[model samples]
Target: MQCVRPLWGLTAAAVCILLLLLLHCHMLREGQLSAGACEVVTLDRDSQPRRTIARQTARCACRRGQIAGTTRAQPACVDVRIVRSRQWCDMSPCLDHEGCDLLQNSSGWTCTQPGGRVKTTTVS
Candidate 1:
C-alpha cells in the first residue's frame, strides 16, 4: 500500500509537469504570455447627454499579418490571407454615387465613383 501511494504521487507530479509544459508551448506558439491578456478599446458616445464613454474590453490582440477571427464568443487570431480569400463584394459595398462591380478576373470586387475614380470606403 505504501509503494502504491508513492507511485500514484509520482504519476500525478509527472502529469502536472506535462500539463505545464504543454501550456507553455501553446503560449509560445501564440506569441502571447497568457490567454485574454490583450484588450480592445471601445468608444461610446451618448448624443442626448453629449458624453463619451471609453471602455477597455478583453479581446485577442492579433499580431501583424493577423486579423480577428470571425467568431465573437471565442475570437482568435487568424492570418490576413485567410480573410482576403473571402469574396470582397460580400464584405464590402459601394457608396452613394459609386457603382459596384466585380473584378474581371473574378478575384474580387471594386467600387467606382462618378468621376472615374475608385472608391475604397463607404460614407460614415
Candidate 2:
C-alpha cells in the first residue's frame, strides 16, 4: 500500500508539471501571435522634391525654340505628342515664358533637348 501511494503521488506531480508546461507554451504562442500589432513607421519624402525639380527641368528643355535669349512668338513649347497618353511636358519658365515639350516615342514619352539649359527658379 505504501509503494502504491508514493507511485500515485509521483504520477500526479508529473501530470501537473506537464499541464503547466502546456499552459506556458500556449501563452508564449499567443503572445507571439499578437506581436504583429507592433509596426514600424516610415517616411517616403526622401529627396522626392529634388527629383521632381530635375525632371521638370528636363521636360521643359525638350520644347522647340524656347531656348534662352530668343524673342519670338514661337509655337507652343509644350505639345501633346499622343492623344491617348497621359504624359505631359513640364518646363521651367524663362522671362515670363515656360518651355516644355511632350513628345511620344515608340518606347515611351521621351523629352530631349540640347545640354538641358533652363532658367532655374525656386518653386514655392
Q: Which candidate number maximizes TM-score?
A: 2
Note the clash tally of each candidate.
0, 1
After superposing candidate 2 on the true structure, give the runs of residues whose Cα lies further than 4 Å from its correct spot.
Answer: 33-124
| lDDT by residue for model 1 (23-78), tens | 98998876653443344445353444543333223367677886654222223555
Top-lDDT candidate index: 1
Error of 1 at 66 (Å): 25
TM-score against truth, every candidate: 0.27, 0.28
lDDT of 2 at 90: 34
- Candidate 2 per-residue lDDT, tens place, 1-124, comes to 8899999999999999999999999996664423212212232332553353332221123334232211122212333333223333332223234454433342222333355544332221
Worst 10 residues of 2 by lDDT: 67-76
- lDDT scores of the candidates, listed in order: 0.55, 0.38
Q: All predictions: root-mean-square deviation over Cα?
A: 10.6, 20.2
Alpha-carbon lDDT of model 1? 0.55
